[model samples]
Each structure stands twice: as structure tokens, then as C-alpha cells.
Target: MTGHDRAPGSRIDTSKPHPARMYDWWLGGKDNYPVDEEMGRKLLAIEPRIPIMARANRAFMQRATRWLAQHGITQFLDIGSGIPTEPNLHQIAQRTAPEARVVYCDNDPIVLAHAEALLRSTPEGRTAYLQADVRDPADILERARDTLDFTRPVALSLIALLHFITDEDGAYDLVDAFLQGLPTGSYLMLSHGTGQFTPKGAAEADELYKNSGITLALRDRHEVERFFHGLELVDPGVAVIDTWHPELGEPVEGQQDFQPMPGFGAVARKV
Candidate 1:
């Protein structure tokens, strides 16, 4: 369900699997229900290294945050912020730059339920959470201004988020809308699932998600890169998530043995 449709205190759906909850299950978090676990297991059967991939994705977020913070960008707007796994985007950013300000937006009620963990910023930093979806960029940007300064540079993070939004859903248009509000030097950090590695398995996974009433738009490398059309890519442009910047963080164990995590990640500047 989209965030606009769900009101505050809305009941969490326990019948079907959700992408956020399933991701939490894959990361070994205890906040997921049986339905999430069932789907997680099913996905695991399809891609046994999904847990490793999840860890790799988290590591990518952490490393990207560090890179942004190190480059003097102290404000962040992370959309599609999933369940707060430890060392979240704010924590990583504030660790590098204590005065950093962050605004997190997510549509999942489950994420809102555990948002307390995401709000614990350092005394010198600030963090706020908004229960909003990526589809509604205007509302998100308006509310985010309470915590972030729109006139200044703000890093926009969309890690592991766009694969759920298909081309028909205006993924590129939504990104442009978000970037349009930010100033020059603002960054867009993204990591999206791709079908380049194993086309057959990706197709099967898409079918499974489609049957479960979820959209899984696994794009190729070229299509994924097109999301950053006008933005200037950072060094090592659009590499596999794990290979983006290995020097920036420790490697996820057994990541090298896997099939490159079936994704692409990159950081780019708006200028």
C-alpha cells in the first residue's frame, strides 16, 4: 500500500509479504512476521546468497554516507528508508560529521513503528522521520524542509529502492522532481537491482513477486545508468554495488563468491 493511503496508526498487513519486511527478514532482523519470513525463504531458495546481498547493500549505504559526509555535504534526505537496521544513514553521516542534519522518509507502517531507532541522532546532529512514499515527492520535500534546508546541498539516497518502481511508474520523473528542489553540489546516491547477472533467475523472481502483487522491475545496466542522465557521476561510475568503493569499507564475507549481487550502485553530483 502507498503511504498516502495509510493513515497514522494504520494496522500492518500480516497476510502478504512486504518488500521492507522481507528485506528485514533477509537481514536477520526480528521485526518481520511469518508471511515475511515465508517469502524471504522462498526468495532464498531462488537466490541463496540474498542475505549476503542484503549485507552488501547495507554496506553500500554506509560507505556512500561516509563518502558524502567526507566531501562536506552535511545534510541528507534519504527516501525509501527501510527498516532501521543498526548504523543507519543518519548514524553513519553523523558519525563522520556530527552536525549533519538528516530527514528520512518511508511508506511502510512497520518502518514508522520502529522509527524511534532512526531518530537517535547525536547531540550535535539532527534526525527526523516522515511516513511518506517516494511516489509523492512534493509532500516529502515539503515536510523534509522542516529538518533539511532546501536552499543548500542535500544528498538524496535511494539505495535498493528504485527496482520496485517500474518505468511505467515515472521513476525518472520522480527523481527529477526531487533533484529539482535541491541546489547544485547536491548528490544522488543509488543502488538498484539488475538482471544482468542471471536473467533467468531474475525473471523467475519477478514472476514470483508479480504473483504476490508486488512489482519487481529488474533493469539492465544501461537502463539503470539512465536514471542518472544529467548528473555527473563520481569516480568509478556505476559499478557493481560491492565494487563501487571497496576501499571505503570492509567487505561483506563471502561476497566475492556470489554472482556480483545482481545490482549496480553509483554516486553523482547535480552540477
Candidate 2:
């Protein structure tokens, strides 16, 4: 990782479940608590393909980051960066553009704790982590500037994040705020969880999270597309997560078996 400041970890709440921890649990990681595993397993029972979806989502991120890096976009600002998974944003980007610089932000203290130890940057590249929420775009931008140059283009990644943010929380406005601070050449690369494929299961999952004191606002295709209203979407616009640039990705088991994958993914440019 780069020399960016690693803020001290906040108290981890083991009382209830956090989406990040549950995600870790699904990915076969041991950083989660019993509460997280309980909820994660319940959700898995509802949608057994979740583990497949999670792995496919990571593959999409790798493809998107590689697309950006190969296109000469060297800086990245990834918000809602969950637990430090393997082949992280920097590792993917720096593979093509060795000088790539990345800034990963997340509100969970667990991400900061593990990211600092697990996320490694190439000798020619840099990586940094910020313990912050996506709602605080100004603060994130400020801290990100320590490693990335805002004057140039950056790929603002919101993969598998916005669905957790409700419209009441100003999801669109939050995205606009982040994009506003970036230049014309900048991009918004995002993947959103959706209920379009199976509304009943999605509703059950949403209700379960609400009962667990978590917000799960799964949007449909049109609503997800609305996030990129003012921007220009890349080719095969807003395709299913696994379908977007599949040639750039390796074969993910069950990816082809599952039609549509219950989410949308896209990469759009400011101008």
C-alpha cells in the first residue's frame, strides 16, 4: 500500500450483521461473526446463487478496472470497498498500468483493519485506504487527493454499493456530488444489486435485512440505469454483471447457468 494515512479502527459492532461481514462470510472468509453468518446463511437459503454472484461481481470489477487502466486511466477512487478480497482494485489496475494509483474507502472499520494489512501495491503503483462513508463525498475526495490527482481522469467505483443506500438517503445526489468533483474525462463504474430478476426473493431478503437493522434497497433495471442518466454508458450498456465484457473475464462457475444474475453493471464517462 501507499504511504496514505491508515486511520485507527473504530469499534466493530458484533451485535448485529453488517453487509461487509456477511459478504466476507459468503466468500468463505472468517472475519465475520455468528450474527453475520446467521443472516448470511439465511439469505443464502433464499438465494443460493449469492456466492456465485459475489464472485462474478469481483470478476466484473477486475474487468472494469483493467478497462480503465488499459485506456490510460491511472487513478481510481473505490467507495464502499468491502473486506479486502484477493486481486483487489490496485492489483488488477496495476497489472496493466503498473503506475496505477488507487484509493479505497469504506465506513466499516473492519475494511480499514484488514486493508492496511492485506492490500499491497506494486512497486510502481500506489494504494491507500480511507475509513469513511460514501455519504461523505467531500471528505473522501479530500483524503483521496493525497494519492490521486483530481485534475486528471479517475474511475469512481461504486460496485455492489448503492443498493445498500436508500433513495431517502439521496443515492443519486451522493453519486452526483462525487462526480461533480471530478473532471470531464472521469468515469463512474458501478454495479448495483437488483430485484428485477426475482422480486419475491428480493423482497424477502430486503425484509430480513430491515428486521436485522440493515437497509437493502434493491432497485430494478430502469432505476439502476437512472444512476448514469447524465453520463455516457459504454458499449453493451447496463448489461447483466456477468455479461459485461465477459471476454475480459475468466469463466465463473454458474455464471452462464444463471440467466441475468439479479443485478446490473455499467461503466459511464462524464463527457
71-122 per-residue lDDT for model 1 (tens digits): 9999999999999999899889988899999888888888888888888888
The number of residue pairs in model 2 that clash at the backbone is 0
lDDT of each: 0.89, 0.89
Best by TM-score: 2
Model 1 RMSD vs true structure: 3.1
Residues forming the 10-long window of minimal summed lDDT in candidate 1 = 1-10
Q: Which stretches of candidate 1 lie over 4 Å from their true place?
A: 1-9
lDDT of 2 by residue, 79-190 (tens): 9989988888888898899899999888887777787643578888888888887999999998898899888999999989999999999999999999999999999999
TM-score of each: 0.96, 0.97
